[model samples]
Target: MLPQDLITEILLRLPVKSLLRFKCVSKQWLSLISDTHFRHHHRHASSGVILCRRTDIIHHVSLAGSNSDYQPFTSLCFIDDSAGVKILQSSHGLLLCCSNYKLGKARSYYICNPSTKKYSILPEPDYVSVSDNSSVYLVFNPTKSLHYRVACVRMCSSSFNSYQVEIYSSETRDWRSSGSPFAAPFDMVFDSGVLWNAAIHRISPTGASLCFDINQERLGAMPGLPSNEKWSRRRLRYFGESGGRLHLIEIYGCSTQFQVFEMDMDYSSWVPRYNVDIAPVVDTFPEMLRNCIVRNDFVLYAFSLLCLQEDEDDSLLLLHIPGQFVSYSLRNRTFKVLNSISTESNNAFQIGCFHAYQFMETLADADQYL
Candidate 1:
């Protein structure tokens, strides 16, 4: 038998694909991978960079790790049409994804570890019906036994103008309805298995926008926008976590000036953090970016625009919004652009339903590593 440290050392070096397959190697290994300590270690070793796709093929990009040269790490392909998935959110080493197509009444949400290839199809949501229009969020809670939870909010725009919330637990394979009712005003986004809890940008007597918390499976008020600032409901684009804080990125319409703010833990306040300028990118590409941001603890992967360059026909340049993916040190108010990223690929890759983890070399860094 391998020594515990030896086994861990070997396991840390293995890619996520191999690790997932090896979960059945032995109960000890299974327990190790499931353990919080090991998970933290795995999350750190995988940080600072990410694997992305430009066209149909998947390739690796350096986001914050040792490979600053922008080297291609791997090439991946789907087995068939059904194999293509769109990543909605990533947490730990696992990814939350759903099939790209809108198949009538077909449940598509799945939790998978792309590195290990271990996937669990979430039990068919109880509240999703052919007639009811509802939105869903998927959450992974470490404090709650590492089980996956799904929350769905449905709006009844009829006479009552009411909404309902329900949660599904993977461990129990059951769905339970929450006691409270909410009013659906705007759409919601989930991070690491909790609703992002957005501020109510618009207010109407009959309807109001609200934020939903995935972990608690409850509804709460969204924190207000920055005070004494000219703001519009549309300019306020809610981004997931960045730099260990719940973040929001607001742009001034194709203009270079933009703002980044962090949401307080109480879900009641907003603190202005940084102002960004994307004017430099306009010279390279004529059009603005249509990108989504996702995070794993301290690092945020800003999925920006995909452009076809004049010289490179088959290749595309991924324009990442700066400051979206950086390391934040609150004590010093200093942030660092991750060094373990690939600069060779002028364009970043699109994250279609993919997952990435931090590459950790030690223990202290692993705390909240995901």
Candidate 2:
């Protein structure tokens, strides 16, 4: 048998996706991979895959490892129709999804660790009466804490004295409502915010600049958008995080030109990283995108920059391209189209809204916490 030190040294180099599968190789291997130290090493050593979902099917592509990562999609669990499975957010390695349960045909929320294929439905949030269907988001950073956190904001103002925020904690396995809220309530759209630091930052066109701190359960304003580029209704905008910093991505409708911006932690200001204008890519796939835009469908929303994977020189552009998802490499400036199905048929293409999240594959023992 190999020495424990040598075994750990070699195992640390293995990609997380492979390590997850290797857990079944043996009890020893499974225990070692589940070790907290091993998980940290694996998370740091490997850049995990980017997960994008096309309705019921969730497609994942590696950030660095192999070029043949165009793997097929994995179908998530939904009670009746696959259409009921909706991914609210992905953090660490777990996906916070809501599905229509067959028990009572009621909407259920679950935290699923895609790596281990383990999931558990959460009990209803604390007795704080959630009347309106509030938009919810997941916050899970394994490096910070073992438990995951979720918060929901009622997009429309409530009749109550203040806009209440509901929170769920995996540690306690219960939900609670915030007692105090900023006088001004949030009114941003769902999927327009990102979890960064200990707070959730939201971008609004009305210049609300809202942020909800999970730890403190307080809402406040932050730095606004850049003064140069004005917000436009035609452009598609999204907020993301990379390297512990917040990012803003704006893609012009049906255009190959996309702009990226990075924000400071304190929400002080915004800085432009690079104006990615893939003229050749557009020139090549002109008809495809043009037809998509002409459809005037909501699924054709702009391609948002999910995560800027860690690469010394080259940057990976993980975009949420409608119908089909593609990755752009800054080094070669080339577009590699990704598909969810393995079959080589153009008819497999379908038009729908899909979310591409910056995912990191980790075996962080979801069942232990949930």
Q: Per-candidate TM vs. native?
A: 0.61, 0.79
Instruction: Identify the leading candidate in terms of TM-score.
Output: 2
Cα lDDT tens digits, model 2, 1-370, are 9998999988877665677788899999999988877776566343445354444455556655454453323656433344366677778777777764455456666677766667777677655433326667888877777788778765335455345677888898778876465444355554567788778777666655778788887776777666434444344355677677677776544556666777866667788876777666555555445555443433343334555664575677765444455667865677776544444322333343345666666767666776
Model 1 lDDT-worst window of ten: 307-316
lDDT of each: 0.46, 0.63
TM-score of predicted structure 1: 0.61
Q: Which regions of candidate 2 fall more than 4 Å away from where they truly are? A: 15-27, 44-56, 63-67, 70-73, 78-84, 101-104, 129-132, 155-162, 183-187, 227-234, 251-258, 288-313, 319-325, 330-352
> 70 in model 1: Cα distance from truth in Å?
10
Candidate 2 displacement at residue 63 in angstroms: 4.5
Candidate 2 C-alpha error for residue 232, in Å: 5.3
lDDT of 2: 0.63
